[model samples]
Target chain A: MTDLPRPSAPPVSAPTPGGSNLDVLKHQFQQIWQVLAALALIYMVFFVLSEPFRSFDTLLSIFGQAAILAILACGTTVVLISGGLDLSVGSIFAVVGVIVGIVLAEYRLPVPVAVLIGLAAGALMGALNGTIQVLTKVPAFIVTLGGLTAYKGIAEILASGRDLSRFPENFQVLGSGYLVPMGIMFGVALLTGLFLTKTRLGNHAFAIGGNEEVARLSGVNVRKSRIYYYMIGGVLAATAAILEVSKLNFAMPARGQSYELFAIAAVVIGGTSLFGGRGGVGKTLIGMLIMQTIIVGLSYLGVGTSVQRIAIGIIIILAVYWDVWRRPAR
Target chain B: MTQADTATPLLRARGITKHYGAVVALDAVDLDLHAGEVLGVVGDNGAGKSTLIKALTGAISKTAGTVEMDGKDIQITTPTEAKAAGIETVYQDLALVNELSITKNMYLGREIVRDTLFGHLFGTLDFAKMDTEIRALFQKLDIRITDIYREAEAFSGGQRQAVALAKTVMFGKRIAILDEPTAALGVRESKMAMDLVRSLKDHGLSVIMITHNMQHVMNYCDRVMVLRLGRLAAVRDVADVDGDTLVGLITGAAEDKVA
Candidate 1:
C-alpha cells in the first residue's frame, strides 16, 4: 500500500554530512523497503485464495500471461499520465491481429513485413484519435468512443466475418513460441518503465496530464506530447495483438473484444488515476500482474467461466473503491 | 539602493489595444517595468488589469500595439513565445501541480537534463542536487520551509508563492508579472510574499505586481500604475501620491496632483 508512491520527493534527512548522511539515506531506503515488503506480504496472503492452483508451472504461467497485460498496461499508464483514454486500443489490437494473419497466411509476406504494417497501422490509428481530439477540443473519451466502433468495424471488414488461420510456420513460432514473445513483453515493460521515469517526453507527459493549461503556459508542447503519447499507446496495443496471434495461431476481428477493459482495469487497479497525472509504468506492472494472477489462478482452480467473469467486474469495482483515500479533502 | 529605476526596463508595452469580438479589453495602455523595481498594477474587477496582464504574458495577442524588450519592438502571440522572450507570469492560482513533489512541480515543464535530452528516470530526478539548488535559492531570499519535496498541496500559501517566484527566476525570466500575490492570503503569508517581491528587486529581476491593495503599493512598489476601465489612468512614484489620492484616481474624479 505504501509503496504505491515512487520517490516523487527528494530524499529527506537531517543535513548531517558525509558518512552519516549515507546512514540517513540507508535509513530512508529501509522505510521504503519496509513498505514494499509489507505489500509483498499482503500479496502472499491472497495466495490462500489461489491456493488450490499453487504450483511452480502455474505461477510461471501466471507471470508469463501477466507480462503481456503488464506491457499493454504500461502503455495505457503513459496515456493516463498524459490525461487520455484509448478505447479504440481494443479494436486496434484486433485489427493488428487480422492484418498480421492475412499478410503471413494469405499474402505470404515476411514476418518483419507484416510486423511493420501492423505497427504502422496502429500508430496511424492513434494519430487520428489525437488529431481529432485536439482539433475539436472535445474530451478524448468521446473521440475514442467513436474510434472504438469504427476500428472494430474495420477489423470485421478485414476478416470478412471469418476467422484467420494457417499462419506460416515462422509466424506461429513467433506467436506461441515459449521464450521470444514472453521475453519481448517483459523487455517492453521494463523499457516503458524506464522511459516513464527517465525521458524528457515522460516528464512532459506527466506535466500535461497534471495541469494541461499550466503546462501550456509553462511552455510544455501540449499537442506534441499528446500525439506522442497516443502513438505509444497505439504501438503497444497492436503489439499485444501480434503476440496474441503468435501464441494462438489464429485471429478474428473479435480477437481483442473486451481487451480494452482488461488494460484499463489493470491500470486503474495499479493506482494510475484516470484523472491523469501521477502514477507510472512500474506501478502499472504490479497492477497488471495482480489482475493476471487473480484471473489465471481462478481458472486453474476450475472456477466457472461465468463466475470468473463476474469476479473480474467485482474486482474492478473494488479497486476503484479503494481510491477513496486519494480524493482531496472536502 | 537599487539601479532598476534608470536601468533599461526589461519590457515596455506602448499604445496597446485588444478586443474580443466587439468589446475592447485593453485600450491604448502603456506600461514599463525595469530591473530592481516592483511596478504595482491596481484596478477593480473588469477594469482591464487582467486583460493587460494576459497581454503582457502573451496569453492574448495585441490587436494593435507593440511590446518592447530592451527597446526593440516585437510580437508575441503565445505564452511559450513570451517565455522565450524572457517574460513570465504567476497567476492567482499559483498553477503548481498539487499531486507532484515541490521540485517536480518547480521543474514541471523545465526539467534539467544530463548527458542526454532525456532527463533522469524516477530515481534520477536528482533529489540531492535539486534540493541543494532550491534550498540555496530559498535561503538567499530568506525563506524557510520544512519540506522541499512534499506535494505543493502541503505547502503554506507563502511558501507556494515563493516557489512560483523561484520557478520564474529559475526559468531565467527577465520580467515577472504576479497577479494578486496577496489577494486571498493571511496577513503573515502576504508579508512573506511581499518580502519575496523585495528579494526579486534585490536580485535584479524586474517584477510587475497586479493588486487592489493600496498598502502594498505604498510599502513595496517603487511606482504605482493605475488602470481605469480599459485605459491608462496614470503611473507615478509612491513619493508623489498617497492612498486617498490613488483611490481618487481610480474613481476618475481627481483632476490634478496637488503638489
Candidate 2:
C-alpha cells in the first residue's frame, strides 16, 4: 500500500487501504479450508478403517447420535462468542432430563406439556446462573462452576438417586425416531446462525464479547445481552436433555456427566475462540461432526472407550493450539 | 433581547462541574456548540477535556449542571440517551470490535433487520442493505476497502479511523465529538483523517475535536476552546488567534487573549 496518496492518484482508486483483494480472499479461504480439510481427513481415515462406516444407515446413525451434542454445542458457540462459558450445561441437562421424566411418568402429563415444563425448568436454571453472574458481579466461570455441582445435586435429589425410565411409546418418538432429534438439531442450528448474524441482540452479544466497555458506549445494554445468551444456553441444554432421555428411555441422576466438556470440545474444534468473540454455529456443527467421527471411528477400530477419550482429549488440545496459532493476522 | 438571543446555539452547557470524591475534575465549565461549526478543545493532561466530553456525551453524571438543546433543558443519564439526543463520540480508543467485520463494527449496537418467512419465526439481518449502505458511505468518504466483510483487525490504523468516522457520520447527524482523530497517524494518513473531519463540516454537522496538535486546530477547527486546571481558560474563533497564543492559554502562561 502506498504511504502517501500520489498527486496523480485518483481520489478513490482501485482496491483497499489494506491489502489486495486476492490477499483477502486467501485469508478468508485459509480459515474455512482448515476445518474442511480436517473433516475430510477424518472421513478418509474412517472410510478405510471400517466398511460399516460407509453405509448410509451408519451415516444417519452417526448424525442421530451427534444430534444431542451438536445442539448443546450450538448453545456453547453462542456463550463462547458472547465471552462467557456455561459449565453448568451438563448439570442443567441432567436436571432437565430428570424433570421431564418425572412429569411424564409420575405426573402422567402429555409429552408436549412435559416437554414445555422441562424447557421452562432448564430456562429457570439458566436464568439463575445469569442473574447471579450479573447481579453479584461474579465471573461466569465461577458462577457456572458452582452451578455444575449444585445442579447435579438438584438432579440427584429429584430422582432420589433412582433412575427413571419407561415412557409412553409416543414419547419415544422424540428420541428413538432419527428424524425428530436430527430435525431439532438442524432447526436450532439454523436459528442460531440467523441470531448471530442478523438480530440486534445477536450483534450485542458479539459486541459485549469483543469489548464490553466499547459496546456499552455504543448504547448496547451489555448486562442484559449477557443474560440473554446464558438463557439461550440453558434452553438449549434442556432441549438436548429431552432428546437424550427420550433416546435412552431412562433418566439417571448421573446422565450428562462431563457432557459440558464434550460440547466445549466440539466448539473449540470447530474453531470458536475460548477467549470469546469471533466464531459461528456453522463451524461449530463441523466441529461436532469431527468429534463424533473420531469417537465412532475409534470404536470401529476396536479401541477401548478410555483410549478413545484420551484421543479426544488430545484432539481438543491440538485444536485449541491450532486456533491460537492460526488466528488470522491481527 | 440579549445579544445571544438572535440565534440559539445548537447545544449549551452552564455551570457544569464534576468531582471524583476528593478531586474536582471539571469546575463550572460553560460552553456552546453552534450548528455547522467545528469547535476544537485543546488542553494539557488532566485539563478536564475528557471529563467534559464524558459529561456532554452522558457517559457520566455531573455534580451540578444544566444542558440545553434548542432552549429546552434535558437530562442525558446514559450514552444511549446521548445518542438518541443526536450526540455521538468517536473515543480515543475508536471503540471498534476487532473480531467483527467492518460492517458489523459499524452497526455494532444498532443493526437493521428485514422481515422474511424465517425472520417471522426467527429474526434475520438485512445484510444486503447494510452492505450497500456501508459501501456507498465508504465511497463517499473516498475510503477503499478490498472487502467490507474483513474484520477490523485486518485494517491499518488509518483505515480504522476512517471506518470510525463513517460510523460517527451514520449515527451522529447533529454533532460529532472526536477525541484525537489524528494522534497516531503518519503525515499523509493524518491528512486523510483531517480531510474526513473537514467533510463532516461540509456536510453541515457540528464537530467538537479535542487534540494536542496546534496545526490541526488552526487548520481544521472554526473555533477553539482551551481548558486549564479543570477550568475554561479560553474560547476563541480560530481566525482571531495564532497557534502560539492558543498554546500559551493552554499552559496558563498568557493572559486570557480573547476576553
Candidate 3:
C-alpha cells in the first residue's frame, strides 16, 4: 500500500483566473442547494395540489401561519449557534401569552404596557435559565427540560385554566391583520441576520459554539454571552406569543405546547447543525417557510391532523439525518 | 542598544512554582526575557514545559509566583488579565475557532466596533476595517491567504500556524509565549514558523518558545533554557552551547558532569 501510486489525486495544474471566486460561489451553493431544492419541491407540490394554493390569499395565510414560528426559530437559531438548546422556549411562549392576557384582562392595563410586561417576563425567564445553567454548570438540555414542564405549570396557574379572550380590535390586528405578523417576522429575520453576521456578540456566540475552551482562551465572556443568547431566545418567544395570542384573539394556558418541537425542527431543517457552530437566520427562514407550506399543503389536501403530525415527525428526522450525513465524518 | 534595555529585562519570572495537590508540576522556576530575543525552553516528557507556560499565561492558577514586566510586579490571574497586561500566548492547540473566518478569529475578543448610535446600542462589528487590518498584517508577514473570509478549518497545518502567529502578532504588545509553535508543521511550515519567531525578535518583541526540537533552539533562539524533572537544569546562550550539549543537559548527563 505504501508503495502504490495514488489514484484519487486530480491532475496537477494551475487553476484558471477567477477559479477561486468560482469555487467560493460553488461552496456557497452547495450549502444552500438542499434547502433550495426542498423549497422548489414544496412549491411544486402546492401548485399541483390546487389552484387556490397558488393564490395571494393562500400565500398570505401561509406567511401568517409561519410568522410566529419564524420569530421563535430566529431566536432558537441564535441559541443553537451558541451551542445550547432551549426546550423551555415553548413554555416561555405560553407563559408570556398568559402574562399578557393577565395584564390586559385581569389588570386592565394598556396594550403597550401589557406587551412590554410580557416581553420583560419572557426575558427574565430566559435570564433565569441562563443563570441556572452557568452557575450549576449543568447541561442546557436538563435545565431547559425542567423549565419546559415547570413553566407550563406556572402558565396553567397564571391563566387559571381559562382561555383569555376578547382583546381590543387594535390588538387583534397585530396578529390577524394581513400584514402585521408577517412584517414582524420579516423584521425579526433581518435583525437576526445582521446580528449573526455583523455583530461582536453574534460572532462570540458562534465562537463559543465552535469551541468553548477556545472562546474562553480568546477572552470571550462565555457566561455573559450565553446569558444574552438565552435572553434573546426568551424575548423572541415572547414576541411570538404576543402575535399568536392576537392572531387567535385568545390566550390559552396550553398555547404553544410542543411549539419547541416545531422551532427546533425548523432550525435543523434550515441546515443549522444541532451540534452548533454553523447555520444562519436566512436558512432558518427558509426552514420556517418549508414547514408552514407542508402544514398548509396538508390541510389543503384534506390530510388528517394525525397524518400531518406523522409527516412532520418524519421530515424532522430526515432533515437532521441529512444534516449529519452532509458533514465530514469524524 | 539603550542603557535601560541592557539594565532591565523585558520580563522576569521569579520563584514561579506550581503544585497540584501532592504533585509538584514546576518548582521555583526563574527566567528572564530581554527585548528582541528568542528564548527556547526544552525538556523531556512531563518536564513541566506546558505547566510553566500555563502559569505564565494565567491559564491555571500558580501555587506561588511573581511575574514582573518593566521592573513592576504584574498579576496574571486569568487569560483576560494576561491580555490586558499585553502578554499573548499561542498555545500548542492554537485556541482558534475552526468555524470562524480568519478575521473573526483574529479579532474574536478585541473586535473593532464603530461608535455610531446603532453601533453603540447594538454593538455592530466593523468588518471592513478588520479585513483591511488582516490584509495588512498578512502582507507584513508575507502570508498570502487568497480568501480572508475562509474558516480556519480550511487551512493547512502550516497555514493554521501562520494564522495563529498572525493573530498573536496582531494583539501581542509585550511578549509572546509560543508552546511548540512549529512542532506540528512540515519542513516548509516549520521554517515559516521559525522565520516568524525571528521576525518577532526583529520587531523588538520578546518571545519564549517551548519545543523539544533542538535544531530550532540552535538556529533561531538567542538563549536556551533546559528543564529536567520539573526543575531548571541549565540556561545557556546559543553561542556557548550546541545541540548535543543541550540534549545532555536535558537528560541530566551534563548536570552530573557539571556537578
Best by TM-score: 3
> For model 2, what is the alpha-carbon lDDT of residue B202?
80
Task: Pull out the clashing pairs in model 2.
Answer: A198-B125
For the candidates in turn, chain A alone yields TM-scores of 0.85, 0.90, 0.90
- Give me the runs in candidate 2 sitting further than 4 Å from their true place: A1-14, A17-30, A49-58, A161-163, A177-179, A328-330, B1-7, B115-123, B255-259
The residue-by-residue lDDT of candidate 3 on B110-171, one tens digit each, is 99997789897888999778888988887788876747677776666667677788887888
Better of 1 and 2 by TM-score: 2
Question: How much of the true contact map at the interface does candidate 3 reproduce, as a fraction?
Answer: 0.41
Give candidate 3 regions above 4 Å deviation. A1-30, A49-52, A161-163, B1-6, B255-259
In terms of lDDT, the poorest run of 10 residues in model 2 chain A is: A1-10
Candidate 1 regions with alpha-carbon error over 4 angstroms: A1-46, A49-51, A161-163, A177-182, A300-302, B1-10, B116-132, B145-147, B251-259
Question: Estimated TM-score per prediction?
Answer: 0.86, 0.90, 0.92
TM match of model 3 to true structure: 0.92
Arranged by DockQ with the best first, the candidates are 2, 3, 1
Give me the displacement of residue B151 in model 1, in angstroms: 2.9
Residues A1-330, model 1: lDDT tens digits: 101112232221222122235654563354244324533654575567667555677667767777655666777889998889988888888888899888877888898999899989888888888989888988898999998999999988999956578787777766574467668877888888767766667777777887787788777789978988998898998888888888888888887777777899878776777778777675676677677666776676677778877877886787677655655542
Clashing pairs in 3: none
